[model samples]
Target: MRVAITGSTGRLGRALMAAFGDAPFTGPSGPVGWDRAAFDLDDAARTADALLDRDRPEVVVHAAAWTDVDGCARDGELARRRNGDATGALARACAKRGVDLIVISTNEVFDGTRRDGRGYAPDDPAGPANAYGASKLEGECQATAAYDAADATGRLAIVRTAWLFGPGAPDFPHKIVRAGEKALRAGSSLWAVGDEWGTPTYTHDLAEALVWLVGEDAVVAPGERVAIHHIVGGGLASRADWARDVLGRVGLDVTVDEVPGSTWSRASTPPAWAVLAPTPLPGREPLRPWPEAMADYALSLRRSRTASNSTTRA
Candidate 1:
């Protein structure tokens, strides 16, 4: 299938590019990428038209969004415009062109109030606790509405993941590693939130899953046009647990002090228990455990530092 990806420079977007490059996606040149500079979401309609007219891709994976949680909380209007309105516009354009669309979303759509420690399913009722979640929920709504309005037969999938971390950008793992090293050098301990918990996903794993979904391998249930799937890391982890694991994996000796989520003053209030139940896809095994994924991430970080040091010496 001819595929195109938006936000091709982002954490997940980069991984998706790598995965698609290896996969057997048929096109004039292979999967086409549109970065923020080339395909601005602000001009969603015009950009979508130009892309569809030029590329005529069979599928478009919409991965671009304003993912800054705190920043979204600061400016709800901006968040809505970028996340909500832009998604609607793109969905409408896709619907008109009869193109399949896979929209990337987050677990924050749920309020995360489940007390039994169970993860939220794809079809669960949504009650966003913050502006970021609210805006994303609106995007989901807008996409669904657009598809329904057009009565489009094309496939529309909402793939929701959580706590993404990987190689491209300075994600949570990078932040923790830097902070841990700093605290160790200062002869102090690193404090991490103990109460807040969620799945820590690796971008590579998500990219592979998305590839499967788009390929002929994945089976869309009969009569289901709009499907929602919670594709996340296999297990759950608290913030402190994640920090300690990351530090230990990297051989950092800094002590991680566990604290409540309220210890830090922030613009956004993340859900405390936002774990997502992984939806089973046919012919595909579930994603590996997060700790296993973290091990690979730690190794990558080590290699990156080694390469950087070598370059500096040269």
Candidate 2:
């Protein structure tokens, strides 16, 4: 079906573009993509009007957000606008145009209480500990409220994911790869948090699942509440584990000095247990293991680095 993706320059947004391309599900989509210039979330009304009134896309993948964890705590109002207000505005516009919206969220909503290692389910209550998490929770609430008020409650599907990896416009995984290269040249090792736990989702896989979910048959069964759904990778992993796999794959042989989250002070608080539960059956194919995903990412980095190196040499 025809779909319009917000924040089309960001990690998951670009992945959605790569996964769906210009002509998704056959035929043309009228092909429109926007970034900070024409589709800033700050311009909520314009963004909404363009998608709802002009493009009239069947699906609006809402991947834009103020994801700066520390900065969010510093200036929460911006986060509220970007995370909550913009989404609320988009949801309202969707309601008016009878379009479905897929809002991608994070797993920081958990309070880190559960230690069963089973991860947090979609039905789990959100008690966010940080400004970033709180703002996202607010966005989820607003999107749902918009649909609920109209009695067409299935329009918004909030997909909560976490520790996302895979290639796209630069993000944490790429940053770490760069840092690792720097550390290797500097004869140093990477320091990672070993205490924090979460699942790492591949961006491409997550985007595919979101596109599929936006097309799924939701019965809107009683008490179902048209609520959030978990779309993260299958297993839980610590940040150190993720780093070790990344560095090891490149044969770096560098030490991953494990440290508690406490050692690395931050402006915002993080939920100690931010793991995302597995997607329900009939979701997507097996979630790619973080190690395997890391290998794939490493290969991508190698290719990109080589291209850059060749250009520089030439």
Candidate 3:
């Protein structure tokens, strides 16, 4: 099972490499790395050609996406092309190649109308509120449509995950850790929004699942139709709680302050409760708790920064 990943440099992409390189075999053909230099996904036809014919990967993980939430609001057109267009092109490429296209979508695609304590199901109606979500939703539509229309439309596996955290890419926890350090230097309490809620997914765990899915031909059902699943961390928590846990793990005694979501307003509206659906994501292991995850992550950042500091001192 040959698996090709589109964005191999990003945080999630790096995590995929790390997790799978350990000792696993997924995909009909062995795993091979693919990234920007290989093919610019913005060019739909060229990208389609590369994925379908050039590499001929049995599974193409479309991890590349325009994930800039605020920037997306300012440039909706670019967002559409990057997130929707790039994803659609790859879906078509996979269809032609008769491979499985794993679309790593986001909870953002659903408008956060679900109650705070409740979880979303795969069949839940989607109503993305912001430009970012709208764009991803469009990708889902195109991906599924391609499969539904064509007999050999590459099998579609649209996996929705959320609140991603891990090393490499500057994701949510990394940003907060950087912020906390800066705030400590300034003698101020770290403040994060407390009201927003969603399940956090560890990048390593999600990558493992993606690779496993790619290896399995069973997911691509009759008609070569695509399958959709929701994969996230085992539980949910607010941004404020997540921050506090991270700070505590990092050995900060300073109280982590929480404020209403309105205080940190952005151009695009964030769904209040875009938690992932638990039902569709089958057989995934329960990820380590958020506190434990933060400890491991914090120490990694510390070790890296400490090494950098020592190098400068020398």
Candidate 3, residue 141: Cα displacement in angstroms equals 0.5
Task: Give the per-residue lDDT of model 1 (tens digit) for 159-251.
Answer: 999999998878888788889878987999999999989999999999998888887635246677678889999899999999999888877
- The lowest-lDDT stretch of 10 consecutive residues in candidate 2 is 214-223
**Whole-model lDDT per candidate:** 0.88, 0.75, 0.76
The residue pairs that clash in candidate 2, if any, are none
Question: Residue 307: error of model 3 in Å?
Answer: 3.6
Model 3 segments more than 4 A misplaced? 23-30, 216-224, 280-284, 308-314
Q: Pick the candidate with the highest TM-score.
A: 1
- What TM-score would every model get versus the actual structure? 0.96, 0.90, 0.90
Please report how far candidate 2 places residue 273 from its true position, in Å. Answer: 1.6
Backbone clash count, each prediction separately: 0, 0, 7
Which pairs clash inside model 1? none
lDDT of 2 by residue, 1-314 (tens): 67788888888878888766733562464334556676667889776887567776777778888888899999888988889999888888887667777788898877776878778888877798888988898888888888888655346778888988766666656666677877887999888889988888889778767656654544133355455778777667888887777766655677889899999779996777878777663645756666666667788877766776698789
Candidate 3, residues 111-219: lDDT per residue as tens digits? 8877646787788888899999999999999888776776664678888888888887677776777788788878998888888888888888788777666554446
Q: Which lDDT value does model 2 have at 253?
A: 72
Residue 215 of model 2: what lDDT?
Answer: 48
Q: How many clashing pairs in candidate 1? A: 0
After superposing candidate 2 on the true structure, give the runs of residues whose Cα lies further than 4 Å from its correct spot: 22-26, 151-154, 215-225, 305-314
